[model samples]
Target chain A: MKTLKIIKIGGNIIDNEAALSSFLEVFATINSPKILIHGGGKLATQLANQLGLEVKMIDGRRITDKATLDLITMVYAGKINKNIVAELQSKNCNAIGFSGADGNTIISKKRPVKPIDFGFVGDVKKVNIETLQVLLEHKVTPVFCALTHDKKGQLLNTNADTIASELAIGFAKYYQTELYYCFEKNGVLRDVSDENSVIREITTQSYQNLIDDKVIVDGMLPKLNNCVHAIEKNVYKVCIGKPEMLYDDKANFTTITK
Target chain B: MKTLKIIKIGGNIIDNEAALSSFLEVFATINSPKILIHGGGKLATQLANQLGLEVKMIDGRRITDKATLDLITMVYAGKINKNIVAELQSKNCNAIGFSGADGNTIISKKRPVKPIDFGFVGDVKKVNIETLQVLLEHKVTPVFCALTHDKKGQLLNTNADTIASELAIGFAKYYQTELYYCFEKNGVLRDVSDENSVIREITTQSYQNLIDDKVIVDGMLPKLNNCVHAIEKNVYKVCIGKPEMLYDDKANFTTITK
Candidate 1:
């Protein structure tokens, strides 16, 4: 199978212009077929504040009301995504940006409101791998923003991590897919404060033990679970670390396995 | 040659929700390979007002400084483009939205500051017909927002009508292309105020006569000139009128010829 890398970058890197430019320089150098997924940065919240739209959050997840969704659609899908594509193009990377609605590349369902209404938030329903494959085959690198649609004229807010995992799993059937999640952290740390305390490898069993010992709690749990989910779904490799890990094979990043 | 329809819809129709939905329904029924280009509506100006950004204009044309360019990028490429794509999808049309940056499908140069400084504005430099043809061949309808980019990582605000004309001229090489400009007016009116005085046919020589007779002046002059330019560039047909003319065969619209 052809090797393909699916890398997801969080807002921390995106919010910093210098860091984003440095990361794109490395991204342009990657040899294999690659896909990029990005999350909306603090700009959305800042804009919401300016526009007098309240930012509602429950358990660290955003409650995407209609206004919030529109704001993100404007910020994430529009400004950030296009800027990245133009930057990549300047580097001759031939990048094309996407929202889930574009070509119906990713169709999602609105989150159920039994517990609490998440407004326009959506969960991944399907990934149109064919459209992606065709783009990749034509040497067009796809950049995706964390927004999906319900296929009924509604654009829904979605999780970037889940989108990366789902896309990796979707393409895993046809390619040797490697999923990478890049954040501010160097890796999943044994000591959250000590940057050097990177866990080189993590298996499902070790993940459970880490939870029992309280080493992995709160926010880290859902993220780690998503990594494990992709691994079990036949993704050849899953890595969570800083952006530098993409070009540095010797880099110590947390690798996930089932 | 396969026929391709390139339709450009102005802001008045886009700004009205009922009219937009009605137009999309008719657009969904276009049997040939089609592409839609839309102008940024008053939403950008409204947002600018809310954000306290000054709106600058020179003879009805927006002077796109960096901030205004970003605003339109967010409005045109982000919110408006995606919503239209989703709406078309709901109507069973596989529409994918693009800014010139996406797939590098359209490339432009920053308009030079000779007489007046139209900051961050771009003129259409090139359109990647191969990329467009590939998308069309795969049954994907492309919807373009009026934003293009300089190769050096800068996004520029562009005029939608010119983009449509250029695209029609670009695609004319591979397909029998027809360009349509849909605005609020039914057609170019012989009497500016009379709705029934639609000029059914306008030849290049007649166009000159209309201009000399002061019948075609002001905003309509540039628009009709663009239509004539497209016809001169080998685009098979060019029409200017309301959106309904797209689906209604008996509908009278202004047709341009050389």
Candidate 2:
């Protein structure tokens, strides 16, 4: 069977140029077909500061008002997206950077708020797998940023983790691909602060225990959610681990299976 | 009439950090309501070369085969677009970078080639002025790069000049905005080699003469065509000049009038 992978890198990984270059080198060596999705929170926050635009957050989710939405759109879809593609090319990796907005690759609907408006934040409603598969067939790596378009043709900021999950599910259904979530941490740790104590594997039952103990907070919550979503959608495997530990046989990580 | 302006910067201008900063300083001082569109040919070509991908050109238009199209989309839509927005913000300019793909701000039709397929090149067919206007109303400067989407949901590479022209026409019709085409050259010169011998103004008759004499060639041809199109579309004024001469009383440039 042909191997397909969805690799996700977050804001911490993408914000550092040197780290991005190092990640690209490792990514180029992967023999299987892959798609990359990235986040751009650092860049967006910096831009917001410069523009005197307030960065509002509601429960860790960015309140994407008009100004914040524009800022994120520019940073995620424009800067971080292209920088990754350029880095991949520097390593002789054939990579193409894109976003949810491209060719309607990811269509979504605006999350209508009851009291406060989200301006342009979208919940992923659909994914166009055929377009992505065509590029992958030509050995081109599809690098995507988390920016989607609503049904009314408005650009909306979406979470990178969510976007990657949706894409993994879509690819899993379309081409039976595996999903890998790579980040700075060493998967889900038994002790929240201990990086070396990586959990070897996780099931639906154990996942709830970790959450009930309040160990998974902030960024890790969404990542776990994505993993569950991918597994439920019948992906071959959903691996969560440190970037370098991906290839290690004994690397501490969590593998989610249905 | 509200003096709205659209300024287009060549891809060459933002080749490096120093050049980008220099341009941003000048860009920050402009008081008029404006929109920015930029090109990223050099960066795209460099990335393509590193990946050992063949860059094809036909009739002076890029043949965006799978590899080339992906590289162009990533570089133009991502890196160049965000960098400009960041630079502008650093200078206290509220700028928002985007692409034709965003919110379907610019919709296009794939350039149908029968003999030799240009996989992802698009000819723009429509512009979503309402989306842009909404951003503008919120005091956000919309910075666009040259990339669009086809109806079939494919990301297509469109010409930067074409994007600027279409945007100028749209803004003019929708908001009565002025259009300025700024480049390295002082203006449309009478002698191609002599930069100082700028043609102050050119009527349709003189423009035809220049075209007949083979004076306009390469990159300038499309720009000239765009200028003529904007003028014909009833834009308030279409000026072709150096960035420095944009607001000069005796600016050495060419103005196209209907």
Candidate 3:
């Protein structure tokens, strides 16, 4: 199988222009057949505040009402995605930007309203592997925003972590896929505040032990869980680290294994 | 040569929800090998007002400074383009949205400051016909927002009329192309007030006569000029009228020819 890397970058890099530029420089040098997925940075909330839309949040996840969804569509899919594509193009990376709606590449169902109705939020249904594969074969790098769509004319707010995991799993059937979750941190840390205390490797047993010891909790918990899930689903490699790891041969980051 | 239809829609249909839905419903049924190019519409201006961003206009053209350019990116490429794509998908049309930056499909140079300093606007330099052909071959209808990118990381505000013309000219090399400019009016009118006074045919000679006679003046002149330009560039057909003409084989509209 051909090797393909699916890299996901969160808001930490996106919110800082210099960091994003530096990150893309590293991403551009990756050998070939790589995809970049980005999360909407703080701009959405800032724009929402400017537009006087109340952002309802239930436990860290945003309650994506119609107005909020529209705001995110404009911010994430429009502004950030295009900017990234243009920047990558400057670096000679042929980047193609996508919302789930584009080419119907990602179809998702709206989250069921039984417990908590996260307005226009969608859980991933499927990724159009053929379309993505064709683009990759043509040497086109896809830059995806954190948005999906129901096939019936609705754009849904989706988690970027989930999107990354889903895409890695989707591509696993055809490629030896490596999934990287790039954020601000160096890696999963033994101490959250001390960046130097990075845990170099994490296995499923180690992850369970970390959780039992309360070393990994909150937002990081779900993200770590996603990494484990991707690895189990046959994504060749899974790593969590800063963007520099893309180019660094001796990069110290948390690597997840079965 | 294979035949392809390229359609451009102005803001009137886009500004109204029901009208846009109606337009998409009609656009959806058009046979394969068609593209849709849409303008930003009044939503950008309305949102600008709400955000207190001053929309600077010079002789009816927006002076796209950085803020205004960002606003339009969110509105034109994000909201409107995605909405149209999703709606077309609902109607079973596999629509893909594009910014010039995406796939480097359309590359432009920032408009020269000598003329009036139309800030971030761009003039079309080249259209990547290969990328577009690939998408079209895959049965994807590309819906373009009126924005292009300079290869060095800048998105420029481009005119939809020019973008439509450029695409028609580009596609003419591989396909017998028909370009349609869809706006609010029935067609080019003998009198601006009367919608029923639609001119049935307009050849280059007759179009010049209409101008000398002062029947076609103001905004309609440049549009007709674009039509004439497209027709002369060997686009098989060029028509200007309301959106309904896409599906109306017997639609009475002004047809442009050499």
Candidate 4:
């Protein structure tokens, strides 16, 4: 089976133009077939503020009301996705931008109202690997925005990290898939204050130990959990770190495995 | 050769939800290999106004400055295109939305800054028919936004009518293409004041006569001219009028032929 790399970039890396351009330069050089999943940056929040739309949140996760959903759809799928595709194209990378709505590539279910209503948020229900395989087979790279559709005509806001993990799991059936979650951090640190204390690797056994020690808390918990979930679902390995981890073998990144 | 329909819908249909929905419903029923090209709706300008940005226009054509370009990319490619794709998907049409940058499907030349510096406006230069043909052969219908790229990482605002015509011309080599320009008015009116005076069929000779008699003027001139250009370029036929003309011959429309 051919090796496929799925890389997810968080808003911190995407928020800065020079950082994004530099990261894309490295991203364009990866020899294996790859998929890029990008998060919504600060610009969407800034634009929402300018438009007088409140950035509703509960538990640090956003509540994507219809207005916020539209804003992110524009910012993520529109401006950010297309710009990334264009930049990749300039590097001779054949890239196409997509939301899940395109080609019915990813159909998601709107979170039920039983719990706190998350408005238009969706949890991905399906990834049409066959549809994506067509693009990969043609050597066309897909740049995805964190948005999915319900197949009933509503675009829902989704988590970019979850999207990457789900995609890796789906493609794992036909390929040795490696998932990379790229953000501003060096890696999962041993001590919260010590940036240099990067944990090189974490197995399922050690992940629970870190969680018990309170070192793995907050946003890192969900992200690390996603990594473990992907690995369990047949992904060869999952890495969490800065975007440079893709190229530099010694880069500070935490590798998660069974 | 297979029959293909290339339809361009102006802002009139898109701005009104009911109308756009009705038009799309009719569009989804067309069984031929088809492509839909859409013009930017009034939402972009409305957004510009909300953002307090000046919309510069010369002789009714927009000057796409950097800000304007970003605005349209958001509204057209992000909001409008994805929504349309989602809607079509709900109707069981496997539609994929595209900006020219996607899959490098359409490449345009930035209009030279000779007499008029149109900022980021582009003229259709090339269409990657093979890339598009792949979608057609796979039963995936494409929905295009009126934005093209210069391959140098710039998305250029393009005229939707021109995009439709260029696509029709390019696809004519492989398919018997019919182009439709769906707009607000009934068709080319024989009398400026009479709504019922639609010119049923226009040939090269009759089109010249219509212009000689002062019937064809203003924006319709350029639109009708595109229709004639598509005819000369081997598109089997070109129709201009309400979208209903696609399914209803009794509906008012002007059919152009060489």
The full ranking of all candidates by TM-score, starting with the best, is 1, 3, 4, 2
Residues B142-173 of candidate 4: C-alpha lDDT, one tens digit per residue: 99999999889889999999999999999998
Give one digit per residue, the lDDT tens place, for model 3 in A1-258.
Answer: 899999999998899999999999989988869999999889999999999999898977789898998999999988999899999998999998888888788899999997988899999998887777878888989889998889999999999998999899999989999999999899999999999899999998899999999989988988998899888899899999987788888887999998
Which regions of candidate 4 deviate over 4 angstroms? Answer: none
What is the per-residue lDDT of model 2 for residues B105-148, given as tens digits with 9 covering 90 to 100? 67788877877677778899998676567556655577888887
Q: Model 2, which residues run further than 4 Å from truth?
A: B1-258
RMSD of every prediction: 1.1, 14.1, 1.3, 1.3
Model 4 chain A scores worst on lDDT over the 10 consecutive residues at A129-138
Q: Report the alpha-carbon TM-score of model 4 versus the true structure.
A: 0.97
Residue A152, model 3, lDDT: 97
Distance (Å) between predicted and true CA of B21, model 3? 1.2
Candidate 4: tens digits of C-alpha lDDT, residues A10-63: 898889999999999998888899999999889898888878888888877789
| Best by the DockQ measure | 3
The DockQ of predicted model 1 stands at: 0.84
DockQ of each: 0.84, 0.08, 0.84, 0.80
lDDT of 3 at A80: 93
Per-model lDDT: 0.91, 0.74, 0.90, 0.90
Worst 10 residues of 2 chain B by lDDT: B95-104
Which is the better candidate, 1 or 4, if ranked by lDDT?
Answer: 1
RMSD of 4: 1.3
